[model samples]
Target: AYGFKTATYILDDGALNGLSNDAPIEKLRALEDQTFTSDLDFKAALSNALGDDKAKQYEAILVTAAAKMNSVLILCGILLFVSFYAVSIGPVMWVLFSELFPNRIRGLAISFVGLVNLTFAFLVQLVFPWQLSNLGNSLTFLLYAIFAIIGLLFIVAKVPETKGKSLEELEKLLVKST
Candidate 1:
């Protein structure tokens, strides 16, 4: 009348201590398998699965079960999303950056600015995992969305249109007197 089709967690140790239930606490033996009821009455074994790292790993458990969807579908969706994001945001940014500075310093300015942008992109990639783990997904994504809105506002107000204007005109409009 028992099966081991999968790993069923019955004993809740650190966080599981919150639940209190019991059938026969006094007569229970050490060999008895832990039951998976929300209530835990009998004293649990002193052994800890988290072990020495329990303090760090005990925060919040984020369970990600594998999706049953087709692999092709998942890959196609990701590719489409990335393609749209890049096409929508990438070229415009390069074009605007190329047009921002005056001709005299344009090459040097773009290189320096591009380096700064690359650094920030690397930082975002590095910090993203920490943000998701510490702040949770909702707040982490909200932070990025807020920054995106602020960037949009700056682009609209500060960045100029390069449609048909010559480099000289843009230099006059954007560059300031020392």
Candidate 2:
């Protein structure tokens, strides 16, 4: 629909003027900006207007444009998702790990916890396709959302504020809280 709109808009402004296919293309275009009910109707009109081969070429161009634009949109959405995770979840998770563990066991704890985190991340990637196929999109995404909400609750109820506090201070604070 978007590509059709763009193609029509371009064609309407005489973009294809003075060309060899001008008359036939114009014949297929809407004179009074009418709506096409379906592809069959449009194709039949185009075939009557300009024959099969020319109509196919025009349709191919429109379809290609729409497909390319759709791919670009999907790419943009993936980028946006990554950017949101980077800013909101990724760094905060590592910072929390650093602040939460005691100095005596910090290195070993961080290494073990980081490995476990990576393992879960790998598992999620591995299971995502299966979940999507079996549970469908809604359930898969809802499960992710539920887990995210649960993590948020855990952070709120359990993770202590390290704001304006040194590592030793934070360690002491956590010990006292526990």
Q: Give each model's whole-structure lDDT.
A: 0.51, 0.61
The Cα error of candidate 1 at residue 58, in Å, is 12
Q: For candidate 1, lDDT tens digit of each residue in 81-167? A: 578668855667767777777777879988998899899999999999887655644466567768867987987887677889887
**Can you give the TM-score per candidate against the true fold?**
0.56, 0.55
Give the Cα error of residue 154 in candidate 2, in Å: 1.3
The segments of candidate 1 whose C-alpha lies over 4 angstroms from its true place after superposition are 1-62, 66-84, 176-178
Q: Which predicted model would earn the best TM-score?
A: 1
Please tell me which predicted candidate would have the highest lDDT against the true structure: 2
